[model samples]
Target: MTKSATKIYILDTNILLHEPFAFLNFEEHDVFIPMTVLEELDAIKDRKKDVSRDARIAIRALEDALVDATPEQIAEGVDMSQYTADHGSTGKLAIYPDHLLNQKNLTLPGPENDNRIINAALHLQREKKPREVVLVTKDINMRLKAKGAGMNKVEDYRTDQLISDIKYLSTGYVEIDGSFWDKVTNCESKTEGRDAVHSVERSLFTQPVFINQYIFDSSHSFAGKVVAHDESKVELADIGYERLMGREAWGISPKNIHQAMALDALLDTSIDLVLLTGPAGSGKTLLALAAALEMIVEKGIYEKIIVTRNTPEIAESIGFLPGTEEEKMAPWLGAINDSLDFLHKHDECRDSSMKYIMEKANIQFKSVNFMRGRSIQNSIVILDECQNMTSSQLKTIITRAGEGTKLICCGNLAQIDSNYLSPLTSGLTYIVERFKDFEGSATIHIAGVMRSKLASFAEKNL
Candidate 1:
């Protein structure tokens, strides 16, 4: 889309579903919601789908803006500044009646909602004079169709995207070039309890550092955590390479340094949140399951384990299945059960051992939609396959963590299943960036695939 001095953004339904009050993100730009978009939201608000709550919120936001306005005021444009006037938003909010569109050859003429939305933007482009009318949507095909129909400005809604590329995401570790000890000239070293800590000058490092981020050297000798830092100094808690590699969660041990770092963070009672991101066979789920078992059953740090994930439109499909929530969700949660099976595969009574472990751990399966309004205390929440979730959805789950509860979010960015989300806008990416500076949160992108040689080759080449 070309730059414009002033512009009007036409919002699509998916934009609101991705973010309920997305209009607030467009600071000072005029906003238009096509009538068809409202109709779609209304049709969706009463459904049993997990997105129905978002649809209701979107409708309420629109109503709050136009509740007091007359029909003429709404048609012309409502001030819509009641919510964000202090944030420098000066643009008007209005609704365009696209049902009355009679334009000939309206963009691959069809009664489909996407076609209607494209035609609405085309109508605005023709009537709004030189002012740009940009169609903002999360649908790629909708954008293509709008552009093919000669609509000049079409774009994806990206107000919530933090990074343009996935590689820029933090991996919770830094590799020193040669020797880390050679760079530490001035340092105050001390032993607090069993931990060896050193306060080193901040100028020794050339890159930015974050709390709980690991620092390691190729000398195969030194490994440490950034426990604290300030403008002039950074504090490091020394963790021997031997200790990290030798750490155990349940009966599982780290196969590599990356997994070792993740296990360290997971086992730490001080850290409340841990995020794991990697490819398909990177051992994210396996390590998380092991840590969860250790915390809940062995260490007695957390009382239970609650596992959940965002399955696209599971609400409708789940109703037709039989049995309880966990039993019905078993098909989707096969990965977790598979990890359990692997954990006890060597036992003579493997099936009985798995059931005993489940009972002993107090494991429960829950849907993401039912997480709100509940305080999860004294539990370890293992949220798997969350690459497709939205930031709002993640916030709901994270905030559910009450006292003595820890949350682990695991995902592979390459396997995002949501049409409205990309690696840049995924909830996992958003949290990994948002919580990098948080003292109680640590994120690790596991390095290699441990599933099999063939799985690793497929991940790299295919």
Candidate 2:
């Protein structure tokens, strides 16, 4: 394609910080970075957070791309094909070094970095006439502002979006037709312990089902787990109602069908990775913690419990808090304490047994900042509020799991607080979609909120 035919994508600072490799996603297109974005990245590179790490990575990548190249070559653009060859992207990376405000007398309200970025895109649009100039950003308000400023083309960075509409994403359990029970009864069945395992033809289902996914009849009397499947047949293991609803994890029981499925996934030793997504008051954190306690304190399955979360600050940094690492992490771990309190109230031993259970369980509160480079083993690691994490951060955390480690990621996509994340592109959704078919992984979406009547009402109507 000609130069004018290929679109020019101007990336905002937040997009780069969200994903350092974002420039590689635009295939065969010209990627332009405003000077202000580089300045912003430089300014934030010294911080002790994921965004700072991403900024450093982006700066290093750009510097490596421009290494040994003359000023003339830099102005012309650098060939970023090598960096993006794995992604099938042939984009050329360029820096818009010229001062946009000086070149074009635009009526921008202020000299903010966002406006400067917009001015750069507008300048490019005017200079490269007829060539599409699209400003890519994760900021919704910035997109609106760009459009309001007469910039026609603006788009979201969509490399990590597994599902366009999250409302339509699978809930990990499907209600089969009424005839499913008859089909199960007729299929080859054999007793495996107390449960009967069945093999049925794939044609029995009208749609495809993922491995480890639960299939329940409309009457809710029979539930089956998809153990294995091929083009022709599916091996299903019957999940007893007793195993689903009757099983208790440290004094906590499954409150609904969604929670039942979540508990099933959580208690299964074969599944190493479990992802739980839901709205607030859906009991995601509580269920995970209860299961962890049962496994650690009761069953002696795991050596310890490690709880961590993405510390997305709404106002100021938590650095001002005076304490050691564990104490510093205490504020972010209030949910864990709350879950423990609920479990304590329901338990027979009350506060004493609760304290003993906590002590014997060897529970450790960790920040996501210090998780990298360490191989965690023989532990149940719970990553709460994962919707605030980027896909790269999720990958880093998951890859740290050592032998005999079970990683449980819990988050509500609707409650994502990160400015750069959306329900579709958050790390929680990324893992849920990517690991749906993996044998050792399972994802459950809890749709109901059982916290309280008032909380549920607010979640539904407000």
Candidate 3:
């Protein structure tokens, strides 16, 4: 097909599934979706997930709008030439078999499946002689095929922006006005020159401001803000040497160099929160627990270690769980207990029972729902499965931390449970996006998978 004077946008199936509202974004362009795209959308009508279902819904609405119009009118409002099996061939095009347009070709196939769509575009290009035959696809292979077919243009269907560059800024000061400082004779935690630092950091984190302040890849935009900083020398709570040693302890030995570095970060008193993200089974939870135990058992720096997570969808609401408060919470706390048991088993030979260590009852478990209206102080809080939290939810959690508290948020962004959130929309993204420049916050994204080969393979391939 030859390039025409008009811009003809040939839509791909993946583009509709990725963003059903794509038509709304394209303006004044002659958009033509291959009939195969509609067939794919029809097959996904029954899917419950928003993306799959919404594609089908959008297609149906388009069909209804075109139902009352003649073929010419339908083509005017919505491109229908691709829906027809018989597209013409002239200079640079070939025709597809009539049988290819039947019901059998509706299902999703591999790269070969996209051949029919390209064929349809070729037919339209030959017949209409449009200015440009541009194939829009999220599928990389499809774009390559369009290029090979000698289409005028091929563009990726990017729905959301990608974040490529990152920025950093100074810390916030505890600046007090002259009158306010005079009224506050206590002046224990007050500091100077903090507001300027915080103001700069906050400006960098939220994306709306950064979009104008800096040039970025619209496909992937990411930013961060700093929350806290430390000028004074900071002290960390200590765990005994015996508990930190040996190979058979809690999956990874603390004597390892990487573990030692992680321990150092966790023990840094200036940092109040740690964000850890990675593939499944990276021992994030275990590492956090071990560091907290060192602080609780060895140094007794804080009151307790608080464990929390978003409630699982399978579990009934809080009221549905049986037994007393502690009993009802046992199901959720089992994972915590499992980590503790591993730590205790590792120290069995040294006669350091976990029971004795926990006898003072410094470990507490709660859910995000229960965290509201409560200010936590003197505790190390671990928030698991944080990928399911929205930006607002994350903001609420971070603001609840009082003095003498440390919080750790850990989860795999690849396996987010929240339906509306992708890796970019999740709370972990929000925290990492907002706090990247903060002096008191540090993030370590674990790339290695410690899980079995099959689990690792599934995470990578599936």
Candidate 4:
């Protein structure tokens, strides 16, 4: 906390791309951006990739930090207090000329950007002596190499990480052993319209339940969500189990209690944001698509359905593959189409049924890349494979929601494909914990797989 004790933290390019405002997170700590990091940002800024926008934003932020500083001052360090709004920042920001370091000081042997960044941290560690010089990056291999090169403090940028362990992530529901009433006998029951409402002492539960999180019995006899709570009492909307299972979306019924809870949330008109995270084949996409059709085609609650997601590395070649954005995105969005086919498989003509449903629902597939600067209104937007995205990328999509629009985000945390993301660090996990207490949001981690025996076996064993 003191000037002498304050650490020197080096920023990596990936850290900035992960969160543009990452520098301000290290309060009172002297921050360093290696000359190599700036060069890397410069190279990345002009690309058509999604990270290009982040690189530009990072550059702007750095420029703002060094606005009035002279070249000498920039090399020495500029006071960071001016850039921070919280007034807690007392450290200085500097661009370390790692390129000027003598060849004998180079610990890592390479011209690669990651190697150069690690060398910068290594030199700083030696100069700072007892003062901690930390290397922060989102890359695991970079951290390992930094530590191997004799850097004392190497860490992943954890400013946006909400939970340290994936197991601790909320499943959006809790199952009570036996009957729920049997455990909580001191319920203050009331009737709100046709629904049963109950208020019980908060101490009765072994775990914390946030707003809109379902609570149920093991027998599947009782189910409800935490509607309201005070310091001592937790209020629940005791929706009957039978009614929950009885709910249907475009002829799709709940196959289990977990699916029932998910359907109950997807069908709720009051909730604007729905987050579905579970294992592969757990009905995340199927349930979301069904709910979208039922709302758009049957209920007419929304005017259209927009499905979008971040495609993987192979999808970067889609420009050469040719066609409209929807056509190019079709390969990555096969899950949505598969769900549609499954929903209509028993119909007189499955392909005809799917075509009619697509037209009737006004369904459109747009890549998440081109969705910027557009305000989507009066529609249901399904964001699939969201676990692979960072929090800022997810924020871009979520902010595009205009009035009368609902966004459904679906993903499997275990199935994350991004090199920089894991279940704990995923945007899906971030938003699930961040929005757990929001009144208009719902998260459901659908348990078990209903896809097929082979898929279920693979999920459990492999």
* Per-model tally of clashing residue pairs: 0, 0, 17, 0
Rank order by lDDT, top first?
4, 1, 2, 3
Q: How displaced is residue 40 in candidate 3, in Å?
A: 27
List the RMSD of every prediction in angstroms: 2.4, 2.5, 13.7, 1.5
Query: Candidate 3, residues 1-462: lDDT per residue as tens digits?
Result: 223544667777766665554554454456665656777787777664334556775686456435656655544444434333233211111112323444453333344558778766665566566366677876777778767876667887543423432222211111122332133222223234432211222222233321101111212221112233234211112222233233232244553323433454566677888877767876677888887887776778878888888766555256677776556666876767777777777574533476666665377777676677889999999888898876657777888999999998888877787545566546677677677555667665555565468887887788
Residues 71-105 of candidate 1: C-alpha lDDT, one tens digit per residue:
88887888656753245566778899998888585
Give each model's whole-structure lDDT. Answer: 0.88, 0.85, 0.58, 0.89
Q: What order do you get sorting by TM-score, best first?
A: 4, 1, 2, 3
TM-score per candidate, in order?
A: 0.94, 0.92, 0.48, 0.97
Which candidate achieves the best lDDT against the true structure?
4
Model 4: residues with Cα > 4 Å off, grouped in runs: 84-88
What lDDT does candidate 2 reach at residue 244? 74
Model 4 lDDT at residue 428: 92
- Candidate 2 lDDT tens digits, 1-462: 987789999999988888887888888998998889999999999976667888999899788777867877777777777663367677688888846457447646567888889888887889889999999998999899999988979999887787889876767777776746775534788897887888888887776678899888766677879998899788889886556777778777887878988998999999999999888999999999999988887899999999999886541255677887778888889999999888888667788866787789988888887888999999999999999887899999999999999999998888888766778988887888888899999889888889999999999999
How displaced is residue 57 in candidate 4, in Å?
Answer: 0.7
